[model samples]
Target: MSKTRQHCFDFGVPPALTLLLGLWGITRNNSMWRDEAATWEAAHRTIPEIWSLLGRIDMVHGLYYLFMHGVFTVFGDRLYCLRLPSLLAMACATALLTLLGSRLVDASTGLATGLAFALLPAVQQYAQEGRPYALVTACEVLACWLLVTAVDASNWCHWAAYGTTVLVAALLNWFSLLILFAHAATIALARTPRAVIARWALSASCAVLGSLPLVMASQAQSGQVSWIPPVGLGTTLNLLMTVVMGALGAYLARTRLASGSVRVSLSALALPLLALPPLLLLAVSLTRPLYQTRYVLFSQIGLALLIGAACHALASRFRRQPRRSIVLAAAVALVALLPIEVPLRSAGSRVDDVLSTADNVAAVRKPGDAVLYIPAARRDTALVSPGAFTGTRDLALIENPRQSNTLQGVEGTPEYIRKAMLTARRIIVVTDDNTSPPASARDRTKEQVLRSHFIRRYETRERGRKIVVYVRRADDRAATPTSRCPCFVRKGSTPTPPGVVPTEQSKSNRTQ
Candidate 1:
């Protein structure tokens, strides 16, 4: 390590930029997406309920739910309140990246690394989300910092801290433990004293032991990740891009730096951290579909460090011949990416704008309205913003999700739902845009009952969800009060309920 003075400017600028960039549109009141809505539903519940819910689903996010539960208790369930932890964690990760880069190379390299991390699109995206990925990323960087310190000082306390952070990171998101494999690879490639190696081994063993319960429990809840598809060409391309960036960075830094040892050490440290976890995931996913970009978001830190090193190296190589031009070019490149960042900061970036769907439905809703979620999993919309569906009866719901200690609560059986559907004249159906007729017998029954009996009235489509209004056909309407909904149309200055469209200058209006 270089014995250089820590410049205040270098130390202060990265985190400040990170915070400003992070808070740019952090307060936007976009309706929470499915995963975030899941967090909101899980965290707002009582501790016992959260625990019980974890037993059945999302055990991997148990610690995060507990943490957010405390945060909600203190801050309330506002948009900023839910996402602030992620913003702060991202800022912290940026700062730690600066420190890690500075330790591995120089102050300038560290500063550049921090700026690169702050500017990363992935970093910006996760920073605004209300999830464990950002927190786990921060913890991963902090653990790496502890590892560097322990290796340098051979201190027992530093190793213990590293072990504790490792366990905490894994508990936050069990997949974050993959960073340990990268760290182990880094240690194996670097030269270290036997005593330091033993202490490092001990710390890693402790982390594994401490994380075992979460590992086991999350495995039991593995169905939560059933959506992740098997690895294919696209997956390979993504991992390759990550590795290529890291390799380019290492090559640039090595060519520019004077010390071979520092160049070799940084390459060993960064390359594995950048490449190993995702590739390992790809290999494992061939049998057990467990690959997701966010699962190894910590890899971005490694890539950022490499980019920073490369930027610093370029500037260093040209320092004697007007370095200002190099800095200007780097600034311009980062500034150009802001256009891409703008959309990412908005609700429109998401597949489902839940708030927009709610607003559209609210506009068309009327008294005596009933609501149903197609395939049932889409019920989070109502839970996310219950006020939007205040007057509407949830046709399939047998209990409130929170009270039932479930993601979106249990639904009535097919026969029960079919009976409930018949009683309501106006029904609003919520469904995923990609949903097809259900394949299971019970789900098929629900689908058949709706399509065969009701006439489609109005349809509103959003990015990832669709809301359809249905009315019983005129032939199916009976004299019973439950058979017809009140109408908005006025016939010859006298209001009449739907299913009784009067003749002679009939008014056409939407029935609620």
Candidate 2:
């Protein structure tokens, strides 16, 4: 193969494959989980509304929300529009990784590295998500590539670009700042020259300084991530496996390349990139619960690089039989990954499907019915599918999400909530299926009121969500068979209470 054709194959194949994988079942059967619902709600809001929302919560995702607002404006607010940017960003990340591998090692290693990255479960998962992590991952790779280039040439422009890219990634998610620690470890391991090290320090410092405002602003909203659990046995095992795999691959590739052959050795770069950020995040999580694997999604790049290097080493070892060996390895990997890949594109794959919950709500709701969102964040279901809740009142809500510039909207106090619940004959409660204790005093209060004041009449579980109907104990006994309420009563269903009338308007509205 000619150099140009080889270069094209190396750079082109991985990203194209990534795009293909991303586009396959991109909608997840038309389901939008709560997290994606948050993105959709935020992006659909006016620009000023998004800005106002950032002031109160999710400041870290401000830039991404704004970017998506533009995307929605241009392409219209379809699921395709919501997730396409992430797909394209992952594709770009794949291309950048290919370039990084080619520049640092051989073309074969670059091709393998890019292909590995594209096929990674984490990468594939995020690539199809509507969130900003994939974009952050792309920026992280671009910054890494620029760092390699800057180290080689020691140019101001390269350092500036690296700093700017880091800033952008941090703006997308402040946790991405953890990558700087990994980069520092890479420079130290490579025994970079004093001048280049100084330049790196300056660039990194500038990036941090640029991101300081978001850091400070996001601290006030730390409660948003208060739900993140502390690292545990499962997390430890996953991290251990990741590190072991990278180390084994690094060991395999060590003999094939001289440390002095490249300005920064691939092992030096890939090892810390794989291991440090997640380890550091988990370490901090010990004192303050802040660890979530998705936060360090960029670390997958390191693993992919190591895998590529390992493949290159194996190819070198079996020069005459390289094709057969590579084909066998690829087949084993694909077969192993097939089960996971198939489910990832399914509606039930995510924690909770907001659209499914909305459909359930629409099916059972009547015009004058009241609704409650336990833990409140489940209000995202209503936010994304407002039509499902057309005539229902949010009994505990003080203001709607957009009006309050909050993700879940502000809620009334416990006393107010209790008083409001007393007025409703039938209430719909949307909550998770898990029996875990409520996360907040408000949620506990909601649960307590439901248990004490209302009788659980009907309940159904769908896609990790539970929609339960609670009828007031006083109204439950005054039931008539003539009422057409769908609260699934086993023998004699609870009828609409006197003065609480069901209207054709609600029925017609739900149909629309």
Candidate 3:
């Protein structure tokens, strides 16, 4: 093959495979989890509304939301449209990583690195998600590739590209700024020329300055991640294991490579990239919780590179049959990852299925039924599937989501909500299966009122969501079983006529 064709072949295959893997079961059975529902809700809003929402919350995701708004405008709102950007972004990241690996090691190693990245469970999970993490990962890999080129050539144009890419990545998610420390460590460990270090410092400084505004603005929205748990023993053990694996890979690669064989040392680049971001985030989380694995999804690129180096080293040991050794290794990896890859494409893989919850609500809903979302954020279910809630009233909502410029619409005050609940003859409650107490006083009031005055007539749990039908307790006969309540009719059964209540035995017989 010609040199150009060889380069194309080396870089093309892994990304093509990655794209195919991402496209496999891309819709997750048309289930949009809460996080993706947040994206869907924001993307469908008008630009002005999105801007208004950013001023109050999610300013960190402001740029991504605007980008996705444009996407939705061009493509129309659909599950594939919501997630295709992430899938494409991940493929781009895989391609860039392949190019970077080829520069740092050899074409064979580069191919291996790209293929390893495509198989990572985290990469697969986020690639099919409708979120910014995959985009952030792509930008970070592109920035790293530009950084390596800039360091090699010491050219102003390359440095400028590196700085611009870093700025874009940080804007997508400020946590991506952590990649800078990894890059700096690579330069320092490699003992690069002072001129190159100077150029890198200038480029990195400019990028940081450009991202300062977002960094500052995102602080105001920091409370959004308050739910992230503090660092624990399990987290520490996982980080330790990751570090051990990277170190082992680096050791193997160093023993195999001769000096001057590659422009950038694979160990210098991959180890820091794999280890620094998550380690630093975990250290910070010790004081104030900020660590979430998704925030540093780009680190997987580092792991992929290290795996590539380790595989290259091991394959070299089979000097008489290196090609067979590589084939065997690839087959083993594919077999090991198959089980994980299959489940990731399933709807049950996510925390909750918004579509399933919405479908259940739509099937059992009756005219004039008041709907309540416990903890309020569960309103996302209705927002993402508005048709399912068309005939019902949102009893606690003081303003609709778009009107309030919030993901969840503004809710009435506790007293107002209590009064609204009192007026409803039948209510539908949509909530999660979390057993924790309500986080806010308003949520507490909602639970208190429901427990005191309403009785659950019918309830079903599906994919971590709880949907319940409740009817007002009869004032004269508080001991009446919910089976006799008008709203207690089983799904697909004839509804009891208005002002007529079925006897418990009659309802039981009918259900049987």
lDDT of 3 by residue, 466-500 (tens): 88877888742554555664443233333444443
lDDT of 2 by residue, 1-512 (tens): 67788668668988998999999999998888888888998998999999999999889999999999999899888889989999999999999999898888877788778888988999989998999999999999999999999999999999999999999999999899999999999999889899999999999999999999999999999988877887899989989999999999989988864533578889989999999999999899999999888899999999999998889788878786443454456557767998998899998899888877777777667778999998799998888777778879999999888899999999999889988998998899999888999977888888888878887766667778888877887877654222443443222222343343433322332211
* CA error at residue 17 for candidate 1, angstroms: 1.3
Count of clashes, each model: 0, 0, 0
Each model's lDDT: 0.78, 0.86, 0.84
Count backbone overlaps in model 3. 0
TM-score of 2: 0.91
Using lDDT as the yardstick, the better of models 1 and 2 is 2
Per-candidate TM vs. native?
A: 0.89, 0.91, 0.92
Query: What does candidate 1's lDDT look like per residue over 49-156, in tens digits?
Result: 999999888898999999999998988878888889999999999889888888887777778888888888999999998899999999999998888778888888
Compared with the true structure, the alpha-carbon lDDT of candidate 3 equals: 0.84
Best by lDDT: 2
Which one wins by TM-score: 1 or 3? 3
Number of the top-ranking candidate, with TM-score as the measure:
3
Model 2, 69: alpha-carbon shift in Å? 0.9
Stretches of candidate 3 above 4 Å error?
1-6, 259-262, 319-324, 475-512
> Against the correct fold, how does model 1 do in TM-score?
0.89
